[model samples]
Target: MTRAFIFPGQGSQAVGMGQELAKSHSVAREVFQEVDDALGQNLSRLMFEGPIEELTLTENAQPALMAASLAVVRVLEKDGNMDFAKTARFVAGHSLGEYSALTAAGALDLADAARLLKARGLAMQEAVPVGIGAMAALLGLDIGPVEELVAEAQAKSVDGGICVVANDNADGQVVLSGHKEAVEAAIEVAKEKGVKKAMLLPVSAPFHCPLMQPAADVMAEKLTEVVIAPPRVPLVANVTASEVSDPDSIRRLLVEQVTGRVRWRECVLYMGEQGVTELVELGTGKILTGMVRRINREMTGSAVQGSQDIEAFLASL
Candidate 1:
């Protein structure tokens, strides 16, 4: 069956995520070490033995998640003898996970990915003050209704704060991001309009909205210093929800993604339309895999996070 490998973004991280893999596989340990050396910090330690508050910080979580995902990829390659270019039809990621996808497809170096994510996380966090911006998940609402609600909320917002669709996650799940007041306004509007649930997310800053323009600018400069090669396989980008293989395009889209909606549902559907029958999530959690199943029941979704999951997946191949 045709397959596309996917990676998870924020909210997938947790303490002890890659500890078992690092213990079971030498290659996994090397991946974590490479990330630590690249950043001049003991990130692996943070991942394995986290004071959850510090590990969950945007700066730490971004690269930490990538490191965990890459560790799984390295083990799958060494022990499973799997080559992504030969084994998978496409690769994709959500938000920061896009960097992991590019790294996995050999378009980006692991060290470069780590440093870039660190910068991205820092920039995103610093774009807006901690309490100035917010994000909210509006459940049981489609994109069209959510967009209307965003417009209404923006109109009602204090000081004209912006509110917009941040993530069109699934058929019934969408996220809104903007100034805290605007997002809170959206939550109230969503409740008034009879949404199943509307509540603020625990994210530190509003992501994938105009409020993050400053962070996007920072990434634009940061991206220019990095070398991006064409991936061994096509990457389904978050901003475009389509396959892209050109190095220049990938670089450009990475910047846009900082303030652009993560069109995850569309990305999954696009892959399915392109004959991808299975989506394998190689990361810390089964979040993306679960989303894949929600996006299309006909498309099989599986995750390979631990040693046993990796072995089972490889054996299936």
Candidate 2:
């Protein structure tokens, strides 16, 4: 049976994430320290003792999550001799988690991963002004219907209410993003159409839509500064739902992901079809692990978030 290593994206972070790992393992602490050094600040403190609001900021949360994921991986490697090629057949991530996946697969160093995530987070935050854009989750809606709803909402706007489907998260769950008015309108329309739930998301900005074009542009320039190497393992890209490791291709897709739909369900389905019977999430939250269970119930799922979890996994092996 093939195995895959997946990573969680944004929205999975919380205060005190990776705290146990930091306190338990020197290797894990080193990962956090490396990230702090790379960013020239103590992000670990913010993550572990967050003022909540500060850690929730896009700029801090993005790399903070990446650092958490890397810390888990470092502890796993330091405490458990889990071979990447032997233990994992594929690697995939949700949105920002893609950077963690690349770093785990040896495509990028931890320092570069931290730096890139910081750049991405700041760029995305600056893409649109606060409170101007919004995101809503539309349940029980297909992609085609959701796109139609977005178009309808956009058309209803007198100005630029550019509502668009951002994330096709599951079979019937989609996240739409654009102007606040447009998103609210789409929610009302979806509720009228018998959608189970249409609720506004608690996010700093409307991400993964046309409004993120400015962020994509920023990433295009900032990514050129980082040295990206081909992955040691095949990566299931978010855009294509297929495995690719070409450095140029990875760079192109990273920029596109700024405004592209996070095809998470598709990526997991692809891994299952490609013979991944085991999926492990190395990070602060089990969000991606839960999604994988929904996508492929037969696959054995594991989450390594602390030194003890890593040790338990190693013992099992």
Candidate topping lDDT: 1
Models 1 onward score TM values of 0.98, 0.95
Candidate 2 — which pairs collide? none
Q: Which residue pairs show collisions in model 1?
A: none
Candidate 1's error at 240, in angstroms? Answer: 0.7
Give me the runs in candidate 1 sitting further than 4 Å from their true place: none
Report, for every candidate in turn, its global Cα lDDT versus the true structure: 0.94, 0.86
Q: Least lDDT summed over 10 consecutive residues: which range in candidate 2? A: 287-296
Q: Predicted candidate 1: what Cα RMSD to the true structure?
A: 0.9
What are the per-model numbers of colliding residue pairs? 0, 0
For model 1, what is the error of residue 1's alpha carbon versus the real structure, in angstroms, after optimal superposition?
0.6
* Alpha-carbon shift of residue 105 in model 1 (angstroms): 0.2
